[model samples]
Target: MKPLLLLDVDGVLNPMSRPTPDFHRYRCTVGAEVYTVHLNPRHGRRLIDLALATGSELVWATTWEEHANEWIAPRIGLPSLPVIPMRPGEPSEHGEMFKTRHVADYVGGRPFVWFDDQVWAEDEEYLRVHQGLADFLLIHVDPGRGLTSRHLGMAHEWLTLTGFSQGS
Candidate 1:
């Protein structure tokens, strides 16, 4: 099976920092809440290239859930991707981030690479113990910086080492 590329919206794609020339500010309304997100349009192409090289499928694992496809994807030039159902503000039993349990369940035994600003040491240990032999990489993106070429490079390196490359 192809590996999964899990993406988080708030910190991984839409940075909280001030916008750069390459980043565009978009005002999105989800229900009654309006969110202003800074997105780099080029990130879409970069992510798609990474997935193609690694033979991975991009999946959304964020609080935005279905709204990511509606708001974030189009702004960044990405096609609709599958979203991992998220229960915002719900606490995890393992004391890790709220998304940890849900992410574990969603990937099953498939290898995956997850990019999120909230990833902690506890989450890594929990997944290491629970995921068994399934290889996984958790990239901690700084919310101030968002996704960068370095982050993409790290993912590519990991996928290649794990034999998840398209040429594998």
Candidate 2:
């Protein structure tokens, strides 16, 4: 199966603290209701380049769903990307569990790389239990810095472990 690279919006890509560092958030009107929206990789070209280079498919594993591409992608100089909405009926749990479970569902027997700062307690346990998900990588980033070469190295390690790396 082709590998899915699952990315989170708020803390992983955009970040809660930055105004669109790698990611960003804002309030906007959607239809009749006002909603807080987020944008990521304010500079997404490099990220997009990296993903394409790695032969990994990108999926928005965030609460933003389709909005991620709609409100966010253009600013970053890229087109829309596929989205993986949060778990249905899961209620608002911590960001990590929500991401973990949802990503597990999103990948659905495929391999994936999960990039987010919120991969909490349940995430570790779930990863521990599901060894086949070993092909799955849980990449954590500091909300302040976004994805860095260090994080990319981790991703590279994971990709290598899973035999997905295209070596130089």
Candidate 3:
């Protein structure tokens, strides 16, 4: 099986720190409330292409949940992808990321590369010590800059080295 690409939205694709006209601003109503998301189109294409190149399954690992498919997917030109479910009011201990626990459960021993702006050393340590069946890569994207070409290059290098392809 291919490795999983766990993607977060706000900082990785949206670059929440920077506000510019280049980003698409949209309002979406998931249930009772309307939420606005800022998305960068280029980031979508870059991620999609990277998934194809790496022979990985792209999965939504964001807090946006299914709303990522409804609001952000079309704007970024990505199809509906499986989402990593986050339980309502999930509690996290100190030094742990909000999504880290759910992510660990969702991956379930599958090799995965997680892209997020909020990854910490504790998150890495947690995965390293607890994960036994699969290799894991935690890529921390800068919220101010979002994802760059260098990040894609690094991901490609890792996937290539991990042997997840018919051939390069």
RMSD of each: 1.3, 3.7, 2.0
TM-score (C-alpha) between model 3 and the true structure: 0.88
lDDT values of the candidates?
0.90, 0.66, 0.82
Ranking by TM-score: 1, 3, 2
Worst 10 residues of 2 by lDDT: 15-24
Candidate 3 regions exceeding 4 Å error are: 131-133, 165-167
TM-scores for every candidate against the unseen true structure: 0.95, 0.75, 0.88
What would the per-residue lDDT of candidate 2 be over residues 29-116, giving only the tens digit for each residue? 6568776645544347766665666677777888778877776667666678888867556754433375566666567777677788
Residue 107 error, candidate 3, Å: 1.2
Residue lDDT tens for model 3, 1-168? 788888888888878675567787778787899877778787778878888888888899998899889888889889999999987566666577868888888888678888899998988877776755478888999988777788788888888898864225
Q: Which candidate number has the best TM-score?
A: 1
Q: What is candidate 2's CA lDDT for residue 129?
A: 64
* Alpha-carbon deviation at 117 in model 2, angstroms: 1.8
Q: List the residue pairs that clash in candidate 1.
A: none
